[model samples]
Target chain A: MTDSIGFGHHQHACTTNNCTTPLAENIREQVQNHPCYSEQAHHYFARMHVAVAPACNIQCHYCNRKYDCANESRPGVVSELLTPDQAVKKVLVVSSEIPQMSVVGIAGPSDPLANPEKTFATFKELAEKAPDLKLCLSTNGLNLPQYVDQIAQYNINHVTITINCVDPVIGAKIYPWIFWQNRRIKGIKAAEILIEQQQKGLEMLLERQILVKVNSVMIPGINDQHLAEVSKIVKAKGAFLHNIMPLLAKPEHGTFYGLTGQRSPTDSELSALQDSCEGEMKMMRHCRQCRADAVGMLGEDRNQDFTLEKIESATVDYQAAMQKRITVQAQITAQMTEKKEQQPHYVQFIPLTSIKRGLTKQKFVHRPILMAVATKGDNLVNEHFGHAKEFLIYEASHTGVRFLRHVKTDLYCHGDDSCGEGETALQRTIHALTGCEVILCARIGYGPWEALVAAGIQPNNDHPYEPIEEAVEKVYKEMIIAGKLDEPLQQQLGA
Target chain B: MSFTINELCTNCWACEPLCPNQAIYEAKPHFLIDSRRCNECEGDYPDPQCASICPIEGAILDSSGQMLNPPGSLTGIPPEKMSMNKI
Candidate 1:
């Protein structure tokens, strides 16, 4: 594993409610903004849960979850499943209209932790673009212990676990079976393993100082009497709050409890359980039982306003937007090259004035940095140093190549005629190339080439007329093979 | 959610731009995805932007350890039919 991976850097210990680790510090600052964790925040702030996870590992008696999570109590269905890019665009659109959107959750519509790759991808992108938005995930706590390290790495502030029961006897009555390892384990054995895993996972999360919320479904005559015990255990384990939601059973839902004609808890019966659990730990009374693609504030579902169709149409191509900036730069470069090419007599043009500053002194802190390619068009390194006015910069590393930006420069070499100052044109050109570690061009004159060497800028004019990306890739690979990619050449050469 | 780029990667530079997270990096043998940065485009694209554009087959694998763009997956031809055609 490399340090570049998201979850590889945390080395802190935070086991108490008063967390002080870097990971815990990030969580503490973010948790208050989340609507689900703070009831006051819910009224002022809104939360949106995107149903990106499509798989589940366990079975619940009251759940007939298909593609999304079973944690949602209401019979809300997901309209459309979106990829990470589409989801981010949808979040932007929804957040624009509903500015109170403070938390972005991935609470089933399936367990977010069950689909690790899909869940984390959405969080990683949001972490970069929407840093202010607190990230929250709801899971079944089946894989919580396994992903606690990753949760810390991504700085996930709030986690909700649908822990219905603490005792195995009561858990068995709630969950019929669980899929563990590679097979299905049913009956009491399944509930025993699940209870053990949930407790261990909850303890691990608390130890890491991640604010946790427990959701328990109150089934009449089933787990209703046992929920107060559930509240006590989770609160003792440092759970922030416990939400006991009333079960909404319907025969058409095809759940085991629903088909068996199980009774749905009345409003008073549900309130009674909440009232009892309130003594042991704080009880949440405001859960809306949101859908997979739910948007807007809690208790109000505005999914109809921003349908998948609307979101898809509103979704701008993020990659194209970043590249569009480069396209504009490229057009400017093409126009400059075209005007320069149109000049019939290149020799007639002379340097207007001598740049008196003796070598455009640049104080650069030597570091492993980016390089630029001088090209006329066609994304090829075909332009000469003296004739070219623009250079496209690229960030190259072991992982991939990224177009950073284009650097503009002044024309320097004028064929046989000297540009006034003794090697002033050469120095001026090299000065423009400052900060860039290397220059990839088709041709460079001896004076400018030597000047580039003096300035500690490695000039590569050997592979002329090659595709710009290929040339850059070759240089990057050569640097990697030579074990000289990590350190700047200026530092290595002591220039 | 990191994916690996095996020797099959052609370095066509197709996958580099579409990566929303910018995890893919340019390396010696081929372009590599920074494991830390790569989410296999889980929330971004149905098929990874890299594998979707890559001309080379079986170049990228998902988190489930399956080839994202396997042979005949794009062509919609059955594997048996493709093998018979190759012969």
Candidate 2:
């Protein structure tokens, strides 16, 4: 938060040895403590990306990094094209394949800040599902100033800002035009606004103690002469690190490269710029500028299909499989609802949506409902669940509850089997999510019985031949009579 | 509301072994949850062994608003539990 600029000493794997190793000190500190970060970290994978700024608004002649939505097998990267669920699944799979994966980064995959919805959603899912994984976002300077507060709330640690040139006069030649406040602005005005926003974003992030890294693309002809100055501006702005990358040119890239057709940065040229950034702003020599969800080495593309692969892998593959599950679930719902409805008058399922609604009804009672046990209903989830469904015998441990029909998890149950399985999963889910501990079941085993006792769950698997709904009501009676539940979990029946 | 594992376990023995539970075991397609034997692990450990060991976050989350562990901090030890936020 101090005004001083910063560049983290932490870097990801720097050698071709493996992209999974932790680089630098900051990440190392976390890595040291993380269960997954030790030498075993080598098993992990790295998914990286370039910023996804659909509209650069400015022109950078040396690079052809921008891409719009197209098919899976395309040249440009996919930006303006992803959903939250898609990103979450990608993080799950990618990190799973290469166990060493410690982070989910959104570097250009579109100026991460510009595509706030896309970026935040992806990170949010990763945080919830894979809290152990770290998150990083890199962006062009355009909208970086806007999302500063959000960065802190999400605990985003590393941010890379692309500052191609600090000199506005030089910047004008590179940027053809820009959209400022809904109006088009030519060269100088665009450059000024951009510089201001970039600086503001950097200052804001530093003040909040988030790591900020500045990236300056070294164009041989255009901003090549402006490297030191650009470095100076960003370093003064409090960038934790500076990455000076050589501009790569491919003639087919587009108008920018076709016209400028400048040569790429030689090895020595890049080294010198890195040296300049080293003294004032710690230089970032390990930048891979990877594609979104890019796996393997930072710079190399090991992905079978980069763009769409990440998205498609997350989609519900068998539409009919989901439909079938939904159909079965509808039946289970009626049965469960009917059972809950039969519970003693004290326990109600009023159909109220939120606590506000229940409070408006002015009725607050501890509806002591029996606890639940979630079974790994999904075929894949079987491994995580050591025991089969046991209402009476439950090993008190957590299990995935796949209430969302679309999501098929590492462990989840589906079908008529899921009715019993899902009910079990749901009961455990209810207790875990709510913290009330009592359950209704047909049977449970001894090992799980003792374990549940240790954790404080009271399992009731004694009922036989009773309507499942009636059995639930009976269980409610036992809890209330035993003083296990004060009233009941309420659902408003009518307005 | 509490959590329990069901049948359908692979007995891959992952969860049971991971369980601070000693609580989990090798069963059918999934694991089982003994209500009499489960407590969301509120006081003993930093995280719910069931959830953490489950290898799934949602697998071991709070049941509705009755959260043993919310999205905030595990240790009420945050300087703010005193409700003061001062050094």
Candidate 3:
């Protein structure tokens, strides 16, 4: 697992006795530099989605399918819809400008499968023009089975299918209707056809050895309770990863769920569901639920920079860009290796039960606590609390400090005149950090400091610009000395 | 009542130029709809320009504090049926 941690550029480890060695190696190579497939690769590589597919075969309650929504960063929203030729040009321009660009995907202003001619045309052009790039697409699975041959012919290896539910009754609630056989079917009947098609498509893709990633939207009071079962079934069906994304239902986007006051799953609720499903399969925790026209690294969107008007006049030298990308990626891999070596060692505390059995006198228990650090990259606790857009979550215990995942949040301080009106943003940030016991940062304002303390999270700025793992270890020791480790997990989390 | 832009706005400038009444204005951390000048596009387009073009869900609200493009409006899926487990 450690060997798979760096930039995903490392060679695959094939055991001599394993029968599936070649297949395993092939899978590794497929996901190695693919940002969305491998979690570690996202930190180093970049991906771009071209919104060429504008028609969808099914209607999802959570999707609005709006264009020219530059501010919104959700799926199905794009600034400019592009033709197949325009999409190829945009990809070339973006790849040249952002040399780390490795994957070109068609995720939709609508379903890619719904617009097969346009989707495949773009892929065909890309395969001929930019042969070095990895090709992928996200689909609703309505037309996936039909397009499997075309997908393989285009050298597209990664396919994401949004599977909300297996049960038709539950599926009916999420999907109102699906267009099949030149007719629009509604309710349970519609859902049944969609579910059947999705399962068949998934199986067909797996049979073809195409890497399949299942995406499920966690709708609170709806599919949330049923996702664990979905995870188990998908994992059994041989899905490489399961990304359970939260339903982005805001009353404003004007989708069905949003209008009815249907609330999105809270960060804790979403994480809890993810943890439960994680035991069954690999859960994708770092997905940004990027826009259809998203460009750049995960959690960062650069679509505005590569709009149709902007890239129309641009010329791309694919050969030169590919050369630069190789050199840049090599340096990133080396840096990641050095960072791994510099990770600090921590003292693992013996379990309370074991201590009790051995000594029969010790009453205190050492509990593992989660710590969130605000960093502007370089793996350091150097970012101010207000300026942080995301926090790197870590678990510090007697077992030592271990990196977990990053939690994205709204900026609490927008700088200058925005500070006074950041009440809601601050609340959202605090909500996002619900499970963490400590917030390690360079600086925090008085309002947020008080809020953090009230929320049972210790806001610390004692170690400014210090390495994250080392600082986390220091804070863990301090907690131990302060006897805070003796408390239960719930108390530490302020639950 | 006029349409209002809430804190959820990322100030992406999508609605600023599309506003028929010229009510949506740029502000810190988000965009704000000037209530005094805002007419909710009553005499113009059937839908408020800000809410029609705004990407972030629930960012724009009507004078009665209701979202102009509430969740069910776009997909036409009823919200009551969405909570399947409850029923």
TM-score of each: 0.50, 0.45, 0.74
Candidate 1 lDDT over residue span A263-366, tens digit each: 98865577567656665665666566667788876645677788767877785444444344335434534553453356322212122112112323232221
lDDT of 3 by residue, A1-495 (tens): 333432221111222332111126677667766788776667668999998876677778898644345567789888777889999999988998887788999998888987788899999999988887889999999888898988888889999999999999999889877767544567899899999999999999999888999999999999998999999899889997889999987655667777677899876688788767765766677688888999987757888877678888887787787788777766866775566566412223334354345433344546778899997654568899998888878777665565556777753234535343545677878877988999999999999999999988999999999877678878887777666777554565665
Which candidate comes out best when scored by lDDT? 3
Local distance difference test scores for all models: 0.65, 0.47, 0.76
Q: Which CAPRI quality tier does the interface of model 2 achieve?
A: incorrect
For model 2, report DockQ: 0.01
As for candidate 2, its interface RMSD to one decimal place is 26.2
Question: Considering summed lDDT, which 10 consecutive residues are worst modelled in model 1 chain A?
Answer: A2-11
> What is the lDDT, from 0 to 100, of the residue A157 in candidate 3?
90
lDDT of 3 at A409: 78
**Models, CA RMSD each:** 29.4, 29.5, 11.0
- Across all models, the iRMS values in order are 18.3, 26.2, 10.7
TM-score of chain A of each: 0.57, 0.52, 0.84
Between candidates 1 and 3, the DockQ winner: 3
Chain A TM-score (model 3): 0.84
